[model samples]
Target: MSLQHFSHQHPLVFIASHGHEIEKVNCSACGELVSGSSFGCVECGFYLHKQCVEAPAEMNHPFHRNHNLNLFTRNPYLAGTIICDFSRKTCENFVYHYSCNLDFHIKCALFSHSIAEKKNVEFQDISRIDPSINTGNVTEELKKAECFACRKPLLDSIYFSPNCGFYLHAKCVDLPAEINHLFHQEHPLFLQFNSQRLSCKICQKPQGPEFVYCCSPCKFALHIQCATIPTKINQPFHRKHPLILQSVDECLPCQICQETTNLNDFVYFCSICKFVLHIRCVSSPLIIEDKLHHEHSFTLFPRQVLYCDACGTLGNYVPYICSTCGIFVHKNCISVPRVIKFYRHQHRIPHTYFLDQNESEPWECRFCLEEVNTEHGSYFCSKCNYIVHVKCATKNSRWYYEVDSTETEEATDSDEPVDLREIHPHNLILSGDIRDFKQCHGCLLPIDTSYCYCSQCDFFLHKACAALRAKKHIWFHYCQKLLKLTSGCIFQCCMCKYFTSGFAYTCDKCKERFCLRCSLLSDMPKCEGHEHRLRRFTGESKELCRGCGTSVHAFICKPCNFNLDWNCITLPLKTQHSFDVHLLNSLITLMITIIQEVIIVIFVKRKGIPNIGFIIV
Candidate 1:
């Protein structure tokens, strides 16, 4: 018999299987197990459930009603993978395919209709939103039930079907299909079932086959709970200001815990100062385990009562204390390296929780050059008498932990040159020749051979200087270690009793001068501008340098009638005078020419020797 259908040519016959004789098979219409009465054809092996065969051949879904959808038993594409456009799930059985290339599962279409109709029949007794939703008495058996919509635990007031024992969360039933969020402003996010297990970009949570707010074109997904997170929040830890949620494009570490914020996760930012905190770091555990510090668990305390055992400074906030061993440490000090190879020490130093007071000699921290309290935490070396305070060892950008101690301490040149990112633009070569006339650009100390140098930039750094962590907590500088430029002036070098017009590293907290010559550079050759070999002449003399006619203090030059001062000898041959528009050359000739013109005037003025120390060079 002819019947109105989408795919079949002839009408399917109503067949049934006797309880003892007929075989069982799956119905093609709904892909469900069929044993009893079924509408099917034996010739083509095509089958359908009696109820599925009665389903309409055309449907107008509430979600997409631009055009009527034709029911297709098999994928119209015939071979390509067909996914329901609405739920983004693989289409298993019947699909309502429209001419506009849209497809949806039969179940999803019915759910859409139920949602559009605002079905509240089952939830009439249980309010959708109530303040006492979680306060109600719930049986243990019913507490295990999950919402049918989101598949989450039915903790909130939910609608329950007594007959089938089906449950649905009140919030899940009322969730909107589409929404616009501030984080993803480019497109409207739609409620979709994520089967690919893509991670949410906002909270960095993995998205399972659950309802998530997603943007199809951008491929961005956020969990429903994560999407509803407030834009601003005030936690007890930071009550002074309300933290605002913001997008961070860079890897910025949280100021409190020193843990970096994920680029994908939202950050609670404070615009007033350079303060940033990670969302996860806000509610840090009150008690946690630290294997490196103590054998027992640590309990976080509200106030700082004493100096930190790790850094030896009075903490600014709460600190962790081990009740069993009486070890006090800063929260930021938990991840300190267990073993480290410092530039000043030859042997590998390991972290020590307590020092032996019975030792013959008192323990001294080599970093600060001060007596270390044996009761506190510090890095120690038993082979050698090396000890360093926790803060002194791991100060911002100080010690490098990127390489293993064995490999970093190895005296081998097989390793490739490394590019010191923000420190220098060129690659630095490792050199261990303190005998060479070179200085480190970082510390301005002589390269004793254990140093890194860049020939192109004329830069040098002690191996320790090269391995310096980008951030550091220097004892001399009050603020953190920050690189700064030096104006071309006579700024006295802090370490060496010399003057430099070159760059000096400084910080915001202190003006402690540190020139590269004193920190990194060592043995050096004669000055380039002067003709004679200059020496470090610190002698009591009323002599003058004829080069600029200035008093000679300490200089590097061969003995001549005209002694050249250190600054005059090191002057660049070609210099641009502020008053002059062009670069001037032949400085020696210019001085001689000026002196020649003065010599004629001196003769006429009747000069008797004129202290004759000054002469044209």
Candidate 2:
């Protein structure tokens, strides 16, 4: 259970001695055999634990399964829940019966099935054929078994249960009662195992239906409930009030005593008066339908006034609101969905809110990329021009959007595009036919051939870019606000320490993840490239490179020892320098007149001149 660089393919690997014996088993995932090597792969029934065939396949999940699943086994006789034809929601789908006891991630246990393994791990030789493979040669006929599927104790990693006397923990028998959840796949899952009191659409409280997903077609449900949520909550009819997730769309009055908005769409208020209320009054399945905003389906408005294109203000309470196209909200503003994967937009952007300005000049929100308007409240995208607020569209479902469904995509020698194996280096190809159509140049979003592309550079990327994360910036450190990830093995280039590829930019406050080939690597950095304006000094590094003074790492003027790297410390303050004049920033007034003409030619050639240094040269 401790082991983790990562490996667990059914191969829990044990050998045994005490005269205790079941004798043999096979199939960590297509190993086949199992008549007494115990069981797995009948036609791909797949089950394991002679030590899980030898573990080490791949993992990273949540209720949001986009890809990153490969590990299967289970003798068949199923029980389901693998739903993700692409965000319909149901644990993001990944479950196997004879094996995956309750875990998931093999494309949610066979979505279209056939998960690209390609073939590699094949090294046999326990001792040629079988001293019984190990525990053999000494048997009283051994057969104490007991795990048709949860009978328990087949001892260290076993799984006999396709139907019978019992024995699974071979880690709970590839656990697949049914699951296709990367955030609810079209819904069609099962496994109640009793425990159903229900209640909590979200905090109404009282759970236990095992873990919770349910959907008998569309009754719709979910519950893991309680990981941590209590920033501010108190409702004895508002109780003097104390609320703050800020950005309240309208004027700012009825947050309780501040008073102003009254009619409807006003989620969590009373900062002073507007007095809005209704996250479900308290919470419960009151109409939802979100595949990260697949066009429209949010209804809950109890009072909704109208204004709030994102945050101009007007609407009042009960607002999980959609108003069709205009904009009017407040239904607890959405939120929740993360399981590993992030490049920024391979189709993982939930927890939304907005609906007003609609976009004319100012715009930004492509799922928390930021910069929006309407007084500071937005989330528009009637289908992409973008707009965001509700604190940049409610981030923190834990983040996962790694989309790289490739056909061929590459581009490095500095044209900028770390790696986009399946359209999502923040996506930006635009044309078409990367092997029959692909697109997602960062939210332009669209794809059709299964995906993972970027072979040479036509471009493509999708498994959500393996969950991009970079907002941990370090222009010179202590600035933060990063976020731009995709995946890795190395990643150090906020602008050029090398070791990079596949874009990056993370920072939830400061785990710091940089990479984007160092944020542009240089058109201006040599020794803090000083034309002026660089602060902070903490310790001391000498500093020097204004393009080629030599000794610089990136941003460090501390009064002009200067230094700039990370791609010239994020260049582009404004540059055109040619065709229509746009070079601004005067390069420190041309490096102070070339150090004032070399200090007046060394003060008149050291006074008294060698012929006055030829009349000051």
Query: Highest lDDT among the candidates is held by which one?
Result: 1
Candidate 1 Cα lDDT to native: 0.59
Instruction: Write the residue-wise lDDT of candidate 1 on 233-341 in tens digits.
Output: 8755455678888877667656556566766457887666434667666677898886654457877775435566666654344467777766667777765677765
* RMSD (Å) of each candidate, 1 decimal: 18.0, 27.3
Question: What's the lDDT for all of these models?
Answer: 0.59, 0.38
User: In model 2, which regions exceed 4 Å deviation?
Assistant: 1-328, 333-371, 375-388, 391-393, 397-617
Candidate 2 lDDT, 1-617, residue by residue in tens = 22211323332322232123332433444333334333233344334534333333544332223334444433222566543222223432123321223343333233212111311122111112122244653233224543322322343353322232112333333344455543346765443321233543333445432334455445444443221233356654446666432235564343222234333333465657646543434454457776553356666554435454334444443355565764544443332221212222222222234343334665544433334554534434343343334433334333333223332322211224334443233444333343433443222133443445555564554444332332222333233234444443333343344332344565556656555434433322443334665432222354565655666444454445555543445443432222333233244334433553565556546563343222100
lDDT of 2 at 330: 42
- After TM-score superposition, what is the CA distance of residue 424 in candidate 1 from its true location, in Å? 45
Clashes of 2: 194
lDDT of 2 at 612: 24
At residue 189, give the lDDT of candidate 2. Answer: 46
User: Candidate 1, TM-score vs. the true structure?
Assistant: 0.44
